[model samples]
Structures are given as C-alpha cells and as structure tokens.
Target: MNIVVRDTLEAAEAAHVAVKQAAGLAAEEAALPFKQARLRAEEAMRNNLTQAKVLATRVGRLKQQALEMARESQAAQRQNSTTDAHRMQDSARELMKEAQELESQAKGFQRMAEATRGGLGIYALRAKAAATRAAQRVNPGGDGPLLLPPPPPPLRPAPRGSAK
Candidate 1:
C-alpha cells in the first residue's frame, strides 16, 4: 500500500510539470508570428535605407554632370562661335535629359524610403502604445516619451571667397 501511494504521487508531479512545460511552449509558439513580422519589417526598412543611399549617390553624379555641361555651354556662348554653340547645346540637352531621368528615379526611391519608414514608424508606435498600456496596468504612474526626437541637421563648410 505504501509503494502504490509513492508511485501515484510521483506520477501526479510528473503530469503537473509536463502541463506547465506545454503551456510555456504554447505561449512561445503564439509569439512566433509577431517576432517574424517584426523581423520582416526591419528587413524592409534596411532595404529602403540602402536604396536611398544608392539613389542619393546617383543624383549627386547626375547633378555634377549637369553642372559640367552648363559650364561647357557657357564657354561656347562666350566664344561667339555658332558651331560650338550648337554642339554644346546638343550636349547640354542630352545631359539635361539624363539628369532629369535620374532625378525622377531618385524621387521614386525617396518615396519608397519614406513609405517604408512610415510603415515602420506606425508599427513601432503601435507596439509602444501596447507596451505603455501594459505598463500602466502594471504600475499606474509610469511616464516617459515613447519616441525620441529627430537628429540635428548636418553642418556644411562656408563658401570660398565669401565674406564672414
């Protein structure tokens, strides 16, 4: 009779532990989708950032090319040569078209980046709001800014030959 009771107690303890472990596993499984969504959102944000960098570089190169073309056209005009003017204008027009196309493409990238960033912002805000609500429930007086302020603008060098 003593041996039977000991066996029964051991079985009951084992069953309770198994149920607890199963509950923990189920909770983790439920959270898996949220974790995956967050990861995917982060990946999209990173891709947008990379695309923005590439577009910015391309836009800079295009602007440089446009400036060079304008300088050539100006030199041709100053020389009072019809042939030079025609050649320079044609070259300038071609460069202008290329530059315009690059600008448009860059704008498209900018829009995409903005959209991705906006989506991430909304997701983060929702998560923050949820966390805040949970925290308020746990401790009725916690207060803090959920979002950080924007960064300061970059400083640039002064122009050459400009007055102080």
Candidate 2:
C-alpha cells in the first residue's frame, strides 16, 4: 500500500510539473470565461480538493470491502468450499485494483489543487492567503459534505446612461 501510494504521488507530481509547463499556453489560448481569474482558480482549487477528499473516501471504502471479501474467502476456505473461496479471492483482487485507481485519481486531484496559477499568480497568492485565514474557522462536520463556499460572483457594473 505504501509503495502504491508513493508511486501514485510521484506520478501526480510529474503530472503537476507537466501541467505547469503548459498552463501559460493553455490560459492564453482559452477564452477568459470570467473576468475574475484568481477567484475562478481559487474556486477551481477548492473543488479539486473536494474531489480529492471524495476519492480518498471511496478508496477507503473500497479497501474495507476488499478486506471483507478476504474475510469471507477465509471463511469459505474453512468450510472446504474451494470454489467459493476462489471466487471471493478474485472479487477481492478486483476491488483492490479499483481502490488503487481511485487512490491515484485522488493524488492527481491533490496535485492539481494549486496548479492553476498561470497569469493569476499574484492574485492567487492573495486569494490563498485569504482562504487560509478562512479555513481556520471551525468547519462544519457530520454526515454532510464539508465543501468551502465558492467565492462571491464578480460585481457587475452599473448600466451606462445616455451621454448628454
């Protein structure tokens, strides 16, 4: 498990570097859908962080399921049901593979959470500082997801009046 996580993290870091190299070109060619690029990137990072959390949760659940299957396989083996044991073992292997993939996805999201600087570097730093301050507040916890509220929408300008 450590090896798997270490390998995935290494791969994601490499991906992060690659993405950074291309980010300037990507940002330039892409239309500025919104006027507030830093706000958008902050929002994007928060969302990616949320996804990473969700993926990690999924991986954890999958690992538990795989463990359950292993336990059942052991029970089957004890009962002399070789066929059932084989089937359960195979299912456990599949579950482990799924967990590994989801773990890698989580790592990727974690790596990308802060990768959207591009031209928004200065603004992004300020936004991150603000967000760090905001995160200090007690996060609501329980059954519900703990997502950060998105930055407020950019203020629109007042309508122009007719020239005198």
TM-score of each: 0.58, 0.52
Q: For model 1, how does the per-residue alpha-carbon lDDT over 1-164 read when each residue is reduced to its tens digit?
A: 34444455556657655655554455455545555677787787778677767877877786777778778878878888768877777877777777678777767776776786677656555555555455455434333222223323442333444443
Q: In terms of TM-score, which candidate is strongest? A: 1
Per-candidate local distance difference test: 0.62, 0.68
Model 2 lDDT-worst window of ten = 137-146
Instruction: Residues 85-163, candidate 2: write the lDDT tens digits.
Output: 9999999999999999999999999888857544457674555544433333322122233234432345222233422
**Cα lDDT over the full model 2:** 0.68
Please list all clashing residue pairs in model 2, or write none if there are none.
Answer: none
Taking every candidate in turn, the Cα RMSD to the unseen true structure, in Å, is 24.7, 26.3
TM-score of 1: 0.58
Error of 1 at 100 (Å): 3.6
